[model samples]
Target: MKNNRYLLLVLLMAVIFFSGCERILDTEGISRITSFPTFQMQGEEIVTVVKGGTFTDPGVTTVEGYPVTSSITGSAYIVPGKTQPTDVVYTSGAVDTNVPGIYIITYSSTNPDGFSGTTTRTVFVLDQQPDPAVDLSGSYASGTSPGATITKVADGVFYSSNAWGGGSTVVIPAYLICTDGVNVNVPQQESTVRIFGHGTVAANGTLNLLMSRPTFGPPPLIDLVKDWVKAN
Candidate 1:
């Protein structure tokens, strides 16, 4: 039991440590910061741009918002219109996009004044089925890892990208939510599901869904659950 507890703790710590990274971009006036999306699909890297951080650098005289306690007497701003602002980077665990569908990302941080803020983002893995038919098995059920590309059956113009596995099964947990920006809610038909392929997944195998039909937000999820089933 002790060993198990330690192992669980280690796993928890590992999870926290691997959760990506963040930083503050200080442009003279300390303007804005944007975080980009990173993922692997069909042996290719896919990145989407994101806008975040409406932070104003309190001032050169202040730390974030509060006044700097001590003067560095050093640490000049990087460039004229910009300087490197102090920030915490969360460069740890990369998100798993091996399975297709929607993913939710939520983050919360507290300011020195005890104020806390939270945010989220959505990642939608493409399904080769451009003209997605109403199939119960799943969507995007096929693909090769290293990653691969397929024309969406549901949408003729769009292309679906995916990662591969050795035709193993995948299962995700009962995730309550993903990102908060978009609004949506669709009840899950079941508690969990098994996914086939790394990137493309169809609705055939058992799967997970939200409680309400989400017209917007999070893209829906089941990858972690699918992977969980495989490892166990």
Candidate 2:
């Protein structure tokens, strides 16, 4: 038992020595404390532009006192930073009003401390008004959600009250655009929830919708398909 105790003590000392050395080596990256700058949108995060109409960017600003690029210094706003930000790049996605699609604009800034911050905006370009004959505004009931309201803003534009099919801790509306009254799309938009999906409506007025959790890449964490029937 005396020999076993000595061996155990040696092993414990070795572990402690190695752990201390490892921590010392790992401190190289975190030797200096730094913080990433945050972004504040000047206008709405989601902008809707009418097809064939001119589109303009409302731009963004810095909230946590971050410097901005010189090009946008006059247009873009900033709070103020300890040091001017370097290597600032404002990349804006192309927006063609003649075509209907979603565009993304991104901005990135790096502070003198080598920390970087980035943000993006989403723009939707499509005709809000649809054919007068098309109307899908009604209460839809599905297995997961019951009595989800679909409010009509225009002939083709509708807002779904329950995008997650109910049971969500926070309820947010999702935009459903159906131009021809057959095909449907849930654009990537920010609300209490970020929604992205597509579905179709049958002749019998049955809605076959599929939704994915908010994600920046393919293969979302949560994928769900809900078939909603119009409540009589």
Candidate 3:
């Protein structure tokens, strides 16, 4: 009877010791990853530019950690002007210059171990004219007449509204090309008669337009000097 008790105790102790050893071995097999691949932006958080200006993409940097068995790959996407987060598309860092608003650029990177990271940057495209001296792009109001709107379509190129008080309500397309900081040459895109106009853009966003009409037999006749004040 005493031998049987001693054998039972020995078996129990062996089982306990083996269980303890197994626990320690399992713990030793597991490892805690202290570092991971991280993605970060290299430059300023906000990039500002005028409309029709080139945008330089400040790329991302990936910090590789231990166990670099795989390489890190990155992609960029743009959240279009004042759009929702779900409205994003992968891009090659090309931004639309026509749209003037806030754009969000998201960059993400992934590693072979399924570890990933992401960062974002903002780009602001302003509608304001780039040259401080030439502020010709804005809405203008002249007396009780229908207001005219002028917007910068490209660098130094502006689109202007049609003249008021015409029998036809059709809008005549007109474009102004700024040769100098103050001088502007208007070229009529479409018109039955040859139209010639010139203007000067003031510092306070005012336009002084001197238009000419076709004379039947002599030099072009000068029309009234129309002063357009920039609308608030």
Q: How many residue pairs clash in each candidate?
A: 67, 0, 0
Query: Can you rank all candidates by lDDT, best first?
Result: 2, 3, 1
lDDT of each residue in 18-95, candidate 3, tens digit only: 999999988994785644557656677666566688887767677763232222221122222312222322233345
Provide TM-scores for the models: 0.21, 0.48, 0.40
lDDT of 2: 0.63
Model 1 lDDT per residue over 1-232, tens place: 9999999999998776665322222234356453332221221122221222121112122124332221111111012222112211112232333432333343344455455444343333322322333222123332122222333222211222322222333222221111221221121212233112121222332223112212212553232222101111
Tens digit of per-residue lDDT, candidate 2, span 48-118 = 66678887777766776777542211111111221122211222336666655456666677777888877
For candidate 3, what is the total of clashing residue pairs? 0
lDDT of 3: 0.55
Worst 10 residues of 1 by lDDT: 70-79
lDDT of each: 0.27, 0.63, 0.55
Clashes of 2: 0
Q: Model 3 Cα displacement at 78 (Å)?
A: 18
- Candidate order by TM-score, decreasing, is 2, 3, 1
TM match of model 2 to true structure: 0.48
RMSD of each: 25.3, 14.3, 17.8
Work out candidate 1's RMSD over C-alphas. Answer: 25.3
